[model samples]
Target: MIEVIRSALPTRCLYSHVVVSGQTIGAVTRIRYDGPGVMVPRVFGSVFFYQPSQKINLCYGEITESATVNQFAEVIAEDLDALRDLGSGVWADTVVNPVRHVVEVGIQEW
Candidate 1:
């Protein structure tokens, strides 16, 4: 997912703050879930958007399903341009099955 956002940009780097050349493109990932260290995707693949070295700190939130997040990658692939227009936020769906990518409180972004 981070690669998708990075590759879309000319700098090929993710930043928390926007630069003169590009907009801020960041991804909040689940670094430590109920999984082992061998999982390649969970491990930070790109240092362009590195998180804190600590994971045992207090978690602000928890995603119920790692599989459901795949839906986001699919959504971005289907319409990267549309996603570019879409602002930062979380999905509205209550189901863990993740059928769609509807943003929660989407209008608030505008």
Candidate 2:
């Protein structure tokens, strides 16, 4: 499993590691984030996962900034119409604390 924590400073670049576990041998499948306010944190980033033999893409997306605190953000390959072509069995869970200006992400593989 992969875990990451990042500062939420404006204009700064942040990244988290995507962890995988279980029968599946791939990269991140989905991403979920939460913050103090009702709105999701505004962060721009992407995640990539690869198999043992060859490098491949599993799932990725861009997160826009939030104007309010009531919004939450999540990106699932199966949920997105454009990402249906991507693989399955892996996903990410994240939390953003606006007050603390930090983000935490957890990746799981099934």
Candidate 3:
């Protein structure tokens, strides 16, 4: 896993390590120190922007900064036991099997 925190005012960058496993392929949890930014009227905000030379710069990474490497590790440790039942390769398969009746019901609803 890989993570980074950048500050626009000080022009500083901080890097953190990420941990990955087969069981939690798409799990992403972020810890923010202060609350999220206010969403006022007529104000637009985004996470990234494009610059010249085909470069990309990110904006407002406070949420990612709140999670240190150790904190993330702790979260992983807490969930490790429950994850044991799911083998490394089990994540690759679909857990939700669809029956013809269910599919038909879903189609009717749509």
Best by lDDT: 2
Q: Kindly indicate the candidate among 1 and 3 with the higher lDDT.
A: 1
lDDT of each candidate versus the true structure = 0.26, 0.28, 0.22
lDDT of 1 by residue, 54-86 (tens): 111111122222321111122223444444443
Indicate the worst ten consecutive residues by lDDT in candidate 1.
54-63
How would you encode candidate 2's per-residue C-alpha lDDT over 1-110 as one tens digit per residue? 12211221122223322333211212222322332333333222222222232221223333332232222233454545434222221223222221222333343432
How many clashing pairs does model 2 include? 11
TM-score of 1: 0.23
The stretch of ten residues in a row with the least summed lDDT in candidate 3 is 101-110
> How should the candidates be ordered by TM-score, best one leading?
1, 3, 2
Candidate that beats the other on lDDT, 1 or 2, i.e. the better one: 2
Q: Encode model 3's per-residue lDDT on 48-85: one tens digit a residue.
A: 21111111121111223321111111223444443333
| TM per candidate | 0.23, 0.18, 0.19
Question: Candidate 2, 45: how far from true, in Å?
Answer: 11
Whole-model lDDT for model 1 versus the true structure?
Answer: 0.26
Segments of candidate 1 deviating more than 4 angstroms: 1-21, 29-49, 52-76, 87-110
